[model samples]
Target: MGERIKLPNDPHSPEFWVAVRQAQGIVGPVATDTISALIDAYEAAWPGLPRKLADSTKEKYRQSLRVVREAWGNLQAESLRPSHVQALIETLGATKPGTANNVLDALRAMCRWACGPREFLSRDPTQGVTHFEQGEGHKPWTPEQLAFASDNLTGMLRRAYVLGRYTGQRISDLVRLGWTDIDDGGFNLRQKKTGARPWCPIFSELEVEMSTWEKRPGPFLLQETGKPFTTNGLWKKLDKVREDHPQLAGAVWHGLRANAVIRLRQDGYTSMQISDAVGMSIPMVERYSRYADRKAGGQAILLSMKERKQDKTVKR
Candidate 1:
């Protein structure tokens, strides 16, 4: 009633906002205004992130930030309640658990960066949020499904799918795969996500797929103009391939990597060996293998039960 509070000029800087909070008595319209400015700055910074990160990873971070802002932009940063974060996560879970977790992680980082290097909040809102539980039933595909999809695929898509399955390279890496990357008995390339170099032995099946494509100097996977396929274009091609085989419409591009992991286990590769071959961390290999092993075990149990039943019928 006596006087209106004024917000700091550089609200985006944590130091500026902290000083404003300390001197201006942190409860009122000014604090709220400062929080709003911080959010605006965060949103504005999203586009520039790609300059510092890979295009694929930058897109992921941008998507995560967009979800968070859409859910909670109106609220003051300090006033963000646990219920608010929970609601955001629940909404994200409707689409994907992994995506929801990624959003939460990005939000956590933003909060930490905005507040200070040290923990500024009294309690972390996302501390106890539960993520979706995954199990072996999430295996990529059945042999029948794989065969059907492969048989229906053609052109670049056919090669792309087969390469992904056999090499276990991500879509980003697969599209850029070139003859130069392939050598005497294997392929060597650095993963865009992890920047780790992995050398995968060329299997006979993959060799057949490679033989189908002509050896060229430009991008291994390209459009008619001979340019490398963008992420969206690559997915669109895969989507078209799925359309031809309706049974595979639900299959994701990354599922090829999962299929490779399952095949590796079936071929007696240890988790560590599979992780090394796929250029993934030990933890990721272990997590993915859990599902593959569970599926394999279930199949073995079913086969054994059927055999036992046949034996009992013969004895009778």
Candidate 2:
């Protein structure tokens, strides 16, 4: 019989491995593969996101995922059920419905990814959760508020405020506006969300404002550094104005778009015309024009129906 191979003093020592290498090869122990946590789903999902999401969208998704982890750290993905998700959204809805809906939407996307080729989880808990009403967070800015901004805002912010109020375009779209976008026709917008080419009339108001400023080399909305601002950067810039003028509370940059639609409606424009001008769907135009409709109808009623002594003129 062949002699047994010589062995090291300590069987588990590095010398033992060395000896094994001299004779028969031995593979080292492998670290165990990690089990995925709730957060892992997000990490995995991001890479596989089919469309290239905007930075704002990516941040929002990351934020929502962080929220889930904070609420339920290392929670088994499969343990999340429809009832659990619904209760979570209900709690968030009490404070910020828009935010709650955003979180829910992000989670739903995660769930779909999990159910897809990746299979991070078995089912989506968010499916049955009813979303809170959006648009309740803020309303259109009033004329007084616009006047306040005009008086208070200075430099780039003043121009930004004017563009938002008049163009009916999102800050994302407006900040990217350049000399190239301007034509003899008007302010041409390739909307970010809809990808629709919309034209805003060169109102005498915006025209006068633009005439005062020298055009920068690139985007019209240039910062002190001669660089175009990201949407968030523009938002932060405008938000600073709020610190000085509290009257602008609830009258954020986005609300300016709504205000434009509302003002157009108030000027006796039909919903269809408003829709065409603003590049909005018919449904959206109707929704925005409701106040205008009621206001006009009430005034018409006052002329026809005699004002009863009991009735005071209803303010719209």
Candidate 3:
């Protein structure tokens, strides 16, 4: 009988109160106030996300929301059917399984927030969604590949490449590194991805490398304007490095991070020690450590008391 309720231009906008008032007259059965309240709850829950999440992670959430809107733009929260969610996930899986699973996770959280404890929708749609399985493949750098890449990379690209391989910091944190972060001992900074602050003890070789460079005003890895290198710019440099050294084609920038992890574990660092050194989660360190152990045929050296007794007996 009255004016029809319209969704706000920004669904997250605070102007939903006006829309809610209008919706009550048109839709008498289901109150718009309830929907607005659910939306508010969802928005409130969004801000308390852990600092460990990187900027890229927030971007992924935005992308997931776009995916959701594209698939089911017309569907109301209360009217959303399980089949709709399944179809949306299927669409996402066709192009990107990993992204799709991430989207499903975000959407599931949103749906839970909207529907409360009960199944307000037809059913729980994202229950059976699965993430893509990454293959177990490590193309470790051969001597020739390493030589080619090192020889071709000149200037800052070379330095960044070498440092990444040696230190194993992710490109995100490595590029933003400044002289202030470095010292006579090592470097210390909060890892951008995990927000974990770590202190790395620099080796003599790295020390020598640092001494060669003058103290710059900005990040160690900088653009022509002396600004810190963005992730995209770093990737572009990586692409150039790969092109220059064709043998290292399959070597991703992140592979250096993996290389560092492997080397640290090989050097007899414990999982916890490596995690602290690399500014990674303990679980991630454990995963890499397990992989390293597998690669080295589980060749761990243990100083057992039984071995000590045997040695003493042999001496006697």
Q: Rank the candidates by TM-score, best first.
A: 3, 1, 2
- Quote the positional error of residue 193 for candidate 3 in Å: 3.3
lDDT by residue for model 3 (1-316), tens: 6656566664443455446545555443434333334444354446654444567665676677666766655455566666667777777678877777888876776675455353444445556655555345344455576678667777778778777877778888888887888755678988886677888767666667778887867688877776778878988887876777578778877777777778888898887888777787776666655667885763433446568789999999
lDDT of each: 0.72, 0.72, 0.68
* Model 3 local distance difference test score: 0.68
Better of 1 and 3 by lDDT: 1
TM-score of each: 0.68, 0.66, 0.68
lDDT of 3 at 70: 66
Considering TM-score, which of the candidate structures 2 and 3 is the better prediction for this target?
3
How many backbone collisions does model 1 have? 0
Model 2 sits at a Cα RMSD from the real structure of: 11.5
